[model samples]
Target chain A: MQSIGIDDILDMESRKRAAFINCLSGAKATNLIGTQDKQGRTNLSIMSSAFHVGATPPLMGLIIRPDPVPRHTLHNILETGYYTLNHVNQDILSAAHQTSARYDKDESEFGATGLTSQFVANIPAPFVAESAIKLGLKLVHHQELAVNKTHLVIGEIQTVLLPEDAVADDGHLAITEHGSVAVTGLDTYHELQPIARFKYAKVGQPVELLGE
Target chain B: MQSIGIDDILDMESRKRAAFINCLSGAKATNLIGTQDKQGRTNLSIMSSAFHVGATPPLMGLIIRPDPVPRHTLHNILETGYYTLNHVNQDILSAAHQTSARYDKDESEFGATGLTSQFVANIPAPFVAESAIKLGLKLVHHQELAVNKTHLVIGEIQTVLLPEDAVADDGHLAITEHGSVAVTGLDTYHELQPIARFKYAKVGQPVELLGE
Candidate 1:
């Protein structure tokens, strides 16, 4: 094994360092966060930082990097207090990646990337029509970490839209059945091949492998 | 499409709700977080909430769920101010999953799970010898989120250990080549099959797919 210290990472060039550090998080959840401005212009942006915050209240969290430019997703979420998280599947991942491109506030990524904006009667935020699993969330907490000035935005899951058969009797969503993809580092995307699902861990019991 | 609202989710059985809500994070970075007590008794716990906090300072964050029982990993990290994040690979994933089993404070999960513990001169925490990618980090920030009482621990990467041949010219680690796996929901593990690596998004530019 090759060992590298913090000094070595600090001495590396910025872009190289970004790639190196980004890979440390391993495979990330790739989602397109959907939102819309007060004037009803929609916004869609790619987010890999979304993670499970709490399951009881169904809280979800996304890490918003310190931005030098305007972030329409963040802006719209602030303006409307609502947003959507749509899974990026194999078919639409390229268009989903394009949502990361910066665009004018008036130019929606949906139009620019050729993805469709989907809306329901109750939620103002748009969900990606191509997404197999869609979640509508309401902003619940926003905080700027005093340590790094980056933002942590948390939302409560208010609505979920998916194919009825996608969920199992035990409540596990067969996400890979719908072709939802996973990400490695900043640019690489990968489809998931089920390995195994183990039974819940118990101290002295024999482990069991639950099929995918 | 089936549309389920918050009321439906709230009305779910506790076990069902846990599984259902856990899938919202999509695929996660499956890691075994290693830490040790002041007395040097080791601990290893499976965590899927590990996410990149920043690359500039090489910061990483892990969501520590609100525990109904004592959390040895959190206790040791707070005690020693250092921990290691070890990527769970295919060969040792079953053992990695076994680390989640509850054991007494003095008994090391490494010994219990049959995974070997490795040590370095400067760090107190143990690293899983079976893990191909290992990162030693120092706790930089710890906060109990006011909204859900869940704890968030942010650490600065201090040491990284990996195979030299695994890194690319662009600094991305070929983790899948080394058999590192990703997770969906809580217990399901998936091996990554590369689809494509796209270039940085640019407005109005043709998208390019770079093969893995």
Candidate 2:
């Protein structure tokens, strides 16, 4: 086995270190966060930091990087108090990745990347038209981390849009069935293949596979 | 497309709602968080909320549900200020999932699940012996979310252990090559298949595939 201590990790080049540490955690959810500023300029950026926060209220949390410069996505979300999370499918991988490039506050990533933005359910924010599964979220909480300058933005789900056949009778949505993809580090995309689905685990019992 | 509004979502049964909402966000990184209490009782729990917080200072955050009952994992981390994050691979999926079952505080998940506990560099916390990649972390910051009763525990990377062949020359670790898996919703695990790897994106330029 190989080991990397703190000192050795610190000695690596910045980009190399970033790649090493970022990919170390494992596969991440890939989505395009769409927000519209008060002036109505739409902002779309690729985000892999979004994670499930809770279920009762349907909350999701996203980590926004430290603000050394102005962050258009964060700014727009704060201004409008709403944003859309659009799954990044294989067909839109390149365009979604391109949204990460730094663009002026006035520039819209939708136009820059050739991705269409469509409003849904009368939500002020725009959802990525290319996304098969889209979510409308209303900001409920935001906190700046003391350890890092990044902010944890939490949102409550207000609407869900998906194909009728995407969801199963038991309420599980087969994400891979819709062609959604996963990401590792900053640039690598992976196709998801469901290995197994187990029933709710119980103590002193053998695990049961779903649909068996 | 079928749409689910907030009213319909709120009306579903709790377990079904949990399954639906949890899986809606997308694929998540699956890991086993290992911790030891002051009494030296070790705890292992499957966690999908682990996400990269930052790269420079090398921080990661795990979202732990509120402790209505004693949470061995949270209690141990708070008591010792150290824990280990071990990747969940295909070989350990069943055992890894079993850790989620409610176990008595005195009973170690390691012993019950048949997973070996190995300590390295005297970290005081145990790592899953069968895991291909493991990390030792020190608690840096923790905060309670007001929206949900969950807590976000942030940790700094202190030590990293992986197989010698796990990392590529360019610092990219092909997690899939290590047989690490991803999870969605609550109980579904997916095998990862690499689609494409691209260089960092720049505005107005075509994305170049890695090694091209």
Give the candidate number with the greatest DockQ: 1
lDDT of 2 by residue, A75-133 (tens): 88888899999999999998998898888878899999999999878688999999999
TM-score of chain A of 2: 0.96
lDDT tens digits, residue span A43-162, model 1: 999989999999878999999888899888888898999999999999998899988888899899999999999997478899999998999999999988777888899999999999
- Total backbone clashes of candidate 1, pairs 3 or more residues apart or in separate chains: 0
- Residue range B57-132, candidate 2, lDDT tens digits: 8999999988567888988998999999999999999999989988889889999999999999968899999999
TM for candidate 1 is: 0.98
lDDT of model 1 at residue B156?
95
In the range B9-110, model 1's lDDT, one tens digit per residue, is 999998888898999879999999999998878899999999998988899999998778899988899999999999999999888888788778888888
